[model samples]
Target: MASGKPIDEKVRSEIITKIRDEGMTVTEASNRYDVGKTAIYTWMRDGVVNSTSSLILENNRLKKENEQLYNLLGRATVELKKSKR
Candidate 1:
């Protein structure tokens, strides 16, 4: 039977976490949390958008770090060449 009540954000987050981080399947989470499979699927879709945003941010940060490392290496190479000359 449906609870006929809204699930709270905290509970929703826990359910999502279990599915994403704990390797729980959608069916398992739906059963364990007493939520509908459709709701869990919707949550997973929404989470993918958020995860994509986070991945973009992380990729930008890594690009900057890589650029800085390349610059540092170039400077070190120049200094090494100067010392050799």
Candidate 2:
């Protein structure tokens, strides 16, 4: 079946809102309205859930924590080995 025209942002948002607001799955919406999974995904990527700040902050925090843990572990291991000898 040929879907007549491309679904616009408003219509896509409505579908997404139904899924989000009513707890409907994309597959369920797709089946119910003759939409496709790809279409739903395309709509999802059209600037929804896009975040920059949290991801950058999270990466920086994880990097600092990892470096601190690595240094602490290395120092503790060296001290333990020195004490044993």
Off by over 4 Å in 1: 48-85
Per-residue lDDT over 1-85 for candidate 1, one digit per residue giving the tens place of the 0 to 100 score = 2365787777877887788889999888778878888887886777635555576689999999999999999999999999999
Weakest 10 consecutive residues of candidate 2 by summed lDDT: 47-56
| Residue 27, model 1: Cα distance from true site in angstroms | 0.9
Candidate 2 residue lDDT tens string, 1-85: 3285776655766777788789999888888878887777766666333343345578899999999999999999999999999
Q: Model 2: how far is 63 from its true place, Å?
A: 30
Q: Which pairs of residues collide in model 2?
A: none
lDDT of each: 0.80, 0.74
Candidate 1 lDDT score relative to the true structure: 0.80
Provide the global lDDT of candidate 2 against the true structure: 0.74
- Return the TM-score for each candidate structure: 0.54, 0.46
